[model samples]
Target: MSNPLFKKINIFLKVNEQTIDSYFNANDPAPIYKRQLSQEFEEYIMNYAPSIKRYSTVTYKLNCVNESDKEYLDPLVHAIRRHFSLKKSIREAEFKKFKKRNWVLLTFSLIVVMFFQGVMPLIFNVEHRIHSAFSNALDVFSWVILWKPIEKLIFYWNPFLKEISIFDKLINAPIIIVGEKKEVAPMEQEYAA
Candidate 1:
């Protein structure tokens, strides 16, 4: 029977054994076994050039081939299986990391919101005095503006809170712009050249 690897190479499958080896050595040694399997498959493809027929999705079979080649192809088949398994593990780990980061950010943003909500009434009464509908509205607006900096500070200090909601971001925009303005000092009359 022909080696499947050899046929894959002929069709430009683009599997780099050396690169695979390097990656396996540097991070994960498991794929090395699969790389060896791939090489063996390539050898079989070169020798027999087996007539391959796709049986199903991700499954293939050799037609009109000798049974003798099966012994040599076993390792190659095992290697392919191992490679896929390792690839799946890597992907799962990455997804978990992404989820962890997202969760942390979300928790932090919620905490900031809670903190703001708790302090709002006290701070508003102190700053504005005599709470009324207008004062309450103004205080809420001021709190919205300050939320960004407060959220950022909390994130920086805690490192655990990172998730910020769209509402929180929108509330911060106007305040951020307002915060950027510098007070104009009393100007002495100076003629521009």
Candidate 2:
């Protein structure tokens, strides 16, 4: 029987997680993705894309890759490409949304913190007990309000960035669609073992 048009895709994986499971079950991507991402990131990507099955060592086949029909292969590739593009756009949108929140939070926090630090003391004339109490309250409140934005900007941004990077890589991944699997000779098989 003749083989399909594309086969033997050798994926040069850059997202080196600790184990194969981590790579496949990209729930959190940490400490691979670490503090940069969440389990939701994995869902966001996988929700639209099908799972890739491994064909051999360091090689994976897309859906219906073993089929000899050229038409079957093309649709899978197109679907995969479309999904990658769609997911990348989603991530970009999410990143922009988070960035906007960070800016807004930062701006509001600056305003409130200034009011507490600069105006509160003046309002209480700096020497009163009320002044000290307000100062302490302001310090604590500022930390609370600003904490999320700080975390989002400093710690949470990396994973989305990494996801985008991975998506880009997959989108541009070198796809080698081989004809079919070749039978191995006894000598080569023994050597491989």
Candidate 3:
């Protein structure tokens, strides 16, 4: 079913072609492609929310209301607000936790890198031990050791930022608080008596 109220709204974003294609291909870009891909879902909501309220007894209105000026009537609106608030909290928490985890991994990788850079020369004759197995291993290991830092630096933060942004939009979105109207039935003569 289609909702006409939001038919003209355009929330679609322009991004890389590969990113656009990935969304349709059922590819799992997850954290990496989150920011661009999430726009589609947001667009979907922009179109659907009006229809949802139009059909249900629940309705929503957008306006500036001070804390003291508001009246609460519907439980459904409260539930919806609570759900989005919880989502916002989870998004914030995930961002903090993921950033901390990335920092920890980066620090460990830095230690491994520093051991090779500063201490290795003093403790082991790396240049003189050329062609030895341990020397070769060190040569290979140094490059391999950089992977975590590279990954954490380049790709790790995208998911948290994108997800948090999505949650923020959702939590702040104005929504229907309650019933659209109350129908009053006319009294019959017998009932009027």
Candidate 4:
């Protein structure tokens, strides 16, 4: 029998690889790539716990909220959906391309974001706040540097919690309390016959 833990890790990696490829394919080299990368990072977190999947789905649902305002929301939804769909098209050709120079691609992305968010602002005399550029660089760097460690922690923490039930109790106690509580209403319910 296959270990469930290993099965989950495999799924997590597969989904992330798909999400990355989708974002990479977009021809326009805008600041949005950084956002997409950050999003994929969150998706990696959700792969382990099924309950947390709602958070990711809610993000997609937000795209559908203003359907009548197609002029604004349509492009945003198309871009998001296109990036996600590319994950499904992964194959030997794409894997080979990705394997050869994943680091190079990451570095190029950082350079593009820095140039636009950093140098371009100066060149164009745009007086945007410094926080915009700094935040973008920081986010990209954090995601790249932190991805592996975060994955390992999420993968192992579940089993570790199972082994040490004490930690589990501590973490789960609040959830249990909230689940058991009843709130009293100011007004009593009245039924008319």
lDDT of 2 at 176: 53
Ranking by TM-score: 2, 3, 1, 4
Candidate achieving the largest TM-score: 2
Give the winner by lDDT.
2
What lDDT would each prediction earn against the true structure?
0.40, 0.57, 0.50, 0.39
TM-score (all chains, Cα) for each model: 0.39, 0.59, 0.50, 0.21
Per lDDT, what order, best first?
Answer: 2, 3, 1, 4
Q: Model 2: per-residue lDDT, tens digit, 63-106?
A: 22234444444433454465667779999999999899898988
Per-residue lDDT value at 85 in model 4? 41
lDDT of prediction 4: 0.39
Task: Give the TM-score comparing model 1 with the true structure, all chains together.
Answer: 0.39
| Clashes found in each candidate (C-alpha, N, C closer than 3 A) | 13, 6, 2, 1
Q: List the residue pairs that clash in candidate 2.
A: 6-177, 6-178, 7-177, 7-178, 29-33, 30-34
Which candidate would rank higher by TM-score, 2 or 4?
2
Q: Report each candidate's C-alpha RMSD, comma-separated, in the order given.
A: 28.8, 13.4, 15.8, 22.7
Enumerate residue pairs that collide in model 3.
59-176, 60-176
Model 4 segments beyond 4 Å from truth? 1-49, 52-60, 63-70, 91-193
Query: Model 3 off-target regions past 4 Å?
Result: 1-73, 126-136, 176-193
